[model samples]
Target: MSYAPQKRHSNRAKRWIITIGVFIVVQIIFIAIDGTFLEPSINDSDNVLAKTVRGVLESKLLTERIAPYSFPFFNLFLIVHVVAILIQALGDSISAIFAKR
Candidate 1:
């Protein structure tokens, strides 16, 4: 059996590391922006739709009597966003594994 060169193997490994690092950074930024800004604005009551939506959200059993403007939508958005991110991460990981081969 022939021995594989270590340098080439390490270089290929470095590419995967960089790819994973970039993926993580991008995900963090996406989560931060969604959590910090987009979600709050979506749930804000500057418009009638937002107020109606907030009222409906406040009537839920889990958040009964909670303030309508207290960012309740943040939790809902967070859960959905996290699930979506997980699915996307799973797909990316599978694709990366296949690509490495």
Candidate 2:
């Protein structure tokens, strides 16, 4: 019954989209710089997820020769952030879809 609350929530989601857009633009700039001027590579990543992945790989029986590749940490960070933002937008969109019924 309270439509005002829904309106406020819409504005919040819109703000989130805008913020994410800005971040995406910044990421594009960084990627451009990285590609055009410098060599981008993560030689030693301290990320917990990456460490876990390495652990799993090492634990596997036939993964001896299949070395753990260098994780593109910065690229992964950019990608995961973008994906998280999209996921938030997706959840909001899904909620709107159900309300339409």
Candidate 3:
């Protein structure tokens, strides 16, 4: 109930938020590069991964709806950032459990 622990938690939360922001920025940079170069070649491959990705890209939910607003990267970043946050949260929880014991 003391203010000290609450302040410490806020600081920790801020640091994690900043870390996730940086991670997402880096991910977007990589996305830009891949979208410019590698994405163009995805359709030409015969691998399962390629096929899966292509299928997702071509799905009506994306092709007919999301694509209309030019929100592909928007969706991509949203999902990526959520995953990054989840991963960090998972790691933090695991560490906290071990530290408690």
Candidate 4:
């Protein structure tokens, strides 16, 4: 039996591991920023970033009436997840291009 299938599977698994690791790291960073800056600014009526964040959260998948406290966190998670996937794809593409050399 050939080992090509096993190698391919290993590579795919590595890619998933890298992606998930990146996602977790980035999510932690976002949470830190939220706790340090956004959470405090959220109560300040003069804070533009807070206002924009609230507007985006409310306009996208939630409304003020039904919006749970976790909605903003969910939004941040979605954004980070997509960004991690994109980073993984981009890294794979770059590696493949260089591998042809």
Among these predictions, the greatest TM-score belongs to 4
TM-score of each: 0.35, 0.46, 0.44, 0.47
| TM-score of model 4 (CA atoms) | 0.47
Model 2 TM-score (2 dp): 0.46
- The global C-alpha lDDT for each of the candidates, from Candidate 1 onward, is 0.57, 0.60, 0.63, 0.64
lDDT of 3 by residue, 1-101 (tens): 45765665687789897987787686676557643544433355898987787677666766566442243544454556667789878987786677532
Candidate 1 weakest ten by summed lDDT: 61-70
Instruction: Give per-residue CA lDDT, model 2, range 1-101, as digits (tens).
Output: 76876786788778887877888697666666654436454334898976775565444332433222222434445556667878877987887677653
User: Given candidate 1, what's the lDDT at residue 85?
Assistant: 59
Cα lDDT tens digits for candidate 1, 1-101: 33344554576578657766765685565556543546434447599988887776565632644322335554444445556657766875775577533
Question: Comparing candidate 1 with candidate 2, which one achieves the higher lDDT?
Answer: 2
Residue 96 alpha-carbon offset, candidate 1, angstroms: 2.4
Error of 2 at 92 (Å): 0.6
Compute the lDDT of residue 100 as modeled in candidate 2: 50
Ranking by lDDT: 4, 3, 2, 1
Winning candidate number (lDDT): 4
Which one wins by TM-score: 2 or 4?
A: 4
Looking at model 3, residue 48 earns an lDDT score of: 92
